[model samples]
Target chain A: MKHNFGAGPCILPKEVFQEASQAVIEFNNTGLSILEISHRSKEFEQVVIEAEALVRELLHVPENYSVLFLQGGASQQFAMVPMNLLPEGGKAAYLDTGVWASKAAKEASKLGNVEIVASSSDKNYTYIPQGFSVPSDAAYFHFTSNNTIYGTEIFEKPAVGIPTVVDMSSDILSRVINVADYDLIYAGAQKNMGPAGVTLVIVKNELFGKSGRTVPTIFDYQAHAKAGSMYNTPPVYSIYVSMLNLRWLKAKGGVEVIEQENIIKARTLYDEIDRNPFFKGTANVEDRSRMNITFVMDTPEQEAAFLNLAKERGLVGIKGHRSVGGFRASVYNALTISSINALVDTMREFEEKTK
Target chain B: MKHNFGAGPCILPKEVFQEASQAVIEFNNTGLSILEISHRSKEFEQVVIEAEALVRELLHVPENYSVLFLQGGASQQFAMVPMNLLPEGGKAAYLDTGVWASKAAKEASKLGNVEIVASSSDKNYTYIPQGFSVPSDAAYFHFTSNNTIYGTEIFEKPAVGIPTVVDMSSDILSRVINVADYDLIYAGAQKNMGPAGVTLVIVKNELFGKSGRTVPTIFDYQAHAKAGSMYNTPPVYSIYVSMLNLRWLKAKGGVEVIEQENIIKARTLYDEIDRNPFFKGTANVEDRSRMNITFVMDTPEQEAAFLNLAKERGLVGIKGHRSVGGFRASVYNALTISSINALVDTMREFEEKTK
Candidate 1:
């Protein structure tokens, strides 16, 4: 099997993928393909309920926080966040860390005033900016915990009392996080969860039923929370696969255990990059993401050669984003330590060959 | 497998569902589940291209139109339609046939002035309102082609110069449709195409880039048309299954052939309902949906018993929506003739036993 490190729509546990595949064909031995089963059916209702309940158990989510599997991904949440929370003349604070964070801020700008509390753009977004205070007057403070493109992660959550919103797409399940730290948390379920369609939104109920604008029915979080995320036919297959992955997480001893393993996998590859002469790490060492490890070869020709070499070693999706071209090894929760070892071994062999 | 007539997240062809399930396990033998594959990968790009191509080929979509596989289903489109097409201070004409149509109009009312040009709510939405004129001054004339809840359908296009928008969520692809008759058409993929997450939107490019509102990036048609539906990581599994289902539709001799089968299936059920003293169809004969066939038993107790009998016969999802509860057998494009026959036979057996 190839070592998959492609960034979000990244790795999922093989067992989870297999179970999901089985469920697709015959869910709970209902003799109905998961795809064909009605979302309103009792069986699927259990799937939704269990998925939500698991999220609460895993995250230790406080009471009154709602867990929703919504469609349109996190991209939709960019607009929805502002549409629902930011009133007609409201202002919100945003941390501009990377492409996605900037995109989220931009979406909010179209709806209302968006104040950039901090940004790392001047430094090519290699590290998360720190020491910038969010205004209490702002409607909410939004930040992305991990940057997939730039390979930076905020190791420390902003210690503030303001309502915080974090887009934890890439690093959601790979680590243990305090659910009570943020008022709202939205993550695209592609990485560290299940697939690309459904977005997981964990929002506090205190914020619900209080939007100032005439929020579109689908964009309104209060409406979704009230209806239990079934205001319409939800993305069934995506949500079910997510449920299977969550089950896998629980079986693997939950987030704390997985987080330690993820740290180990990342350290192995980063240690190799630091020791090897032919390669250089990209992101600042302190803020480098454990999930997405970015590095570069000595030259473009060397980088090109190493990519093919990695591919030959059954390492796929090691090629990095074009904006920061080199390599990105996304070691998500599902990527095994052996896969990271394989990638590290390939890197060392490539260096020897070049020398 | 059971006869899946559940109103969407509905039935898909067995072959298509099987193929989709297989793909979920290992897509293209990449050892990566289609669920876990990166949307940026060439393999997935091809899936998206081929799916869009299949849509164009099967529907004879015009060169000037853009086909999008979007998330958020049709409920989001209720707001998106007006957000993309309805100008500021503009008014649009809406035909309030049933639940979905009214929901669409209600969403539009939040954005701009909505004229309820015609409504069948006066008759409990059991028939499509006819002989109503569309206002030329309106920005668009919007309607739902089929109402899954009430078993009503609009058979004829509005004879108006205004742009036409149809939410074909329940009946799309079961019959042939003229591409030029409507400027834009959107359908949730669940019923006639694939599943509940991905929505199919075919919009004329000419009508785009003309909207007066600053549509949220996710809601803007022009933005999606420009990106070719890759603005976000799409509902990958849903779109891929839709492609597989669309391919099946083409192999089955396209919509024309399927429409004929649908007609026959509906006829058999309607014939049985009309001939027997036990049941009666709810919709007016001329406007009753061929897609969703709604019927009621002579008494509430008999209705309960018939549902039990239908379930006992390995038949399912024949329960009517609560709004007009009795039975709603939604025979979409993927529902087979044999399944219809099974439903008919069960009805006859129940009727004879009760008598």
Candidate 2:
């Protein structure tokens, strides 16, 4: 059997994709394609409303927080968060974890002043910097929860005194968190939640109304809040599929249960890498991600051989990002424990063959 | 048979959605879910490259033009077009045809001097304004090609001496046009295309490097152009479904054949409205849109009864925008001729019963 470890647009529950395929043809027996349904209609509105509520309930978001199914993914939010939340000429603090954080910092700098509080890029982001100081007077502090490429994650969310924005694009819903602690949290749906079109944004209502900027209605959190994420034609199919995935997650038990399974999956593969001398892991062990596990062979030649042999054995998408040349096995929420075991077995087989 | 007349997030061809649904699961038997496939993979990259080529081929885009897939819909472009293309303190001539045009004007006004060349709002946008003049030294002349709410369209695109930017969100790909005439053309995918979450932007390459403003990377057409629309994690499912729709359109004899069918669909409904004294067609005949046809009754009683009766008979989503205070039948490209024929039959039955 083949195991897909593609770091995202990554694995999704088979049942969710199946139900989504069916919905595309006949949405709740409406005899109309989901694509054709009006966003404001009773049926479609239920999707946005229920999806929002589920996100809030699952994450334990406070009543003051508004959940939005926005378009443009987390990359867009990198700019929009600063644009709508930052007061004109305001300064924001950012932690440079990896590529995503760097991109966020660049976009935020365009709208207002952004100071990089700390960066692990000096060591090629092989680890997440700890104990960074956020500016007291900044608009907000920003950080990426997980570095997908570098295979590092801040297991514990940093404590920022001021309002905070976290890009949880790669690791959201994989585990439970204190939703009330965050002022704004956005996740691109492609990785752990759903497909690629929708970005889930949850924001504290009170933190807004301070920006004093005329944000384009599409970019404005208040506009999305009032409309319940249906201000314009939303990513209907994507959101519907997200609803299905969330439902699946709830059925398998919510984030808390899934977090246990995720821990088991990550540990199984990491143990194999640690005990086996044939493969060397990339990121610092303490800062390693439970989702994306990056590793390499003892030599470049062995790495190439291992990749080819693994592909021949139906293990696909194990190649790491070019910036960090190695192999990465992304075991997201939908990644079964069996898939991780298969990778570990594949690695063991490679080791025996090389020996 | 059920007929959907949603203004947009509207109907697509039955086969398009079916094929798209299949791809979500298998996607060329890659054994990985489409969601699991890497965007950098040759398989998915080919999908985007081919989609762009198909768009260019269908539009007969000039060699100087490049097709790009973007996020946040046309609403985002309302600001981005000016932000990336409009030089600092430069004046842009805008013809406000309807709601969308006014939105574009509002966004452009934020960046630079906006000269309102003409406005059809004097007639509540029920008729298109004629004999408009563009500023001789304007940056570009911007207008909405089809007003979804107002049911007015520029049947013949106006010639502006300066560069022209047209929001063809509603009627795009339904009719043929000289793509080279406009410097930029953008269309949201939900209407007459495939789905939400993807916006098609076809722009003249020469138009860039003229704007002095340091636009955010996501908002810059050049940034997307350089990355071939993979500058960020694109709305993958949306784009893949769009490719399916485009392929289906091509298989069904391309735009020319579909355009004729759209004309027949519009003429059928418009003819019924003109013959029935109970109905009053809203837009002027010369400016009436072939896509969105708006009409109303003399009394609120008639309007309420008509809507309820139609709903009972499996006619869904025909209600117009509340701002317009009437009914609208949006005959996008995928809307079958038989659907319009059924609506006309329904209209006739209603008129006879009332009389």
Number of the predicted model whose lDDT against the real structure is largest: 1
Candidate 1 C-alpha lDDT tens digits along B188-225: 99998997789999999898856678888888888888
Across all candidates, the chain A TM-score values are: 0.98, 0.98
lDDT of 2 at A90: 95
Root-mean-square deviation of Cα positions for candidate 2 versus the true structure, in angstroms: 1.6
lDDT of 2 by residue, A103-163 (tens): 9999999999999999999999999888788889999999999999999998687888988
After superposition, the stretches of candidate 1 with alpha carbons farther than 4 Å from their true spots are A209-211
Q: What share of the true interface contacts does candidate 1 keep?
A: 0.80
Docking class of 2: medium
Q: Write the per-residue lDDT of candidate 1 for residues A19-129, one digit (tens) a residue.
A: 887877788988898988999899999999999998999888898899988998889899988887887888999999999999999999999899999899998899888
Displacement of the residue A165 alpha carbon in candidate 1, Å: 1.1
Q: Candidate 2 residues B144-252, lDDT tens each? A: 9999998999978787789999999999999998998899999999887778889999999998867888877878899899999999888888898888888888888
Provide the lDDT at A249 for model 2. 90
Question: Best-fitting candidate, measured by DockQ?
Answer: 1
What is the TM-score of model 1 when looking only at chain B? 0.98
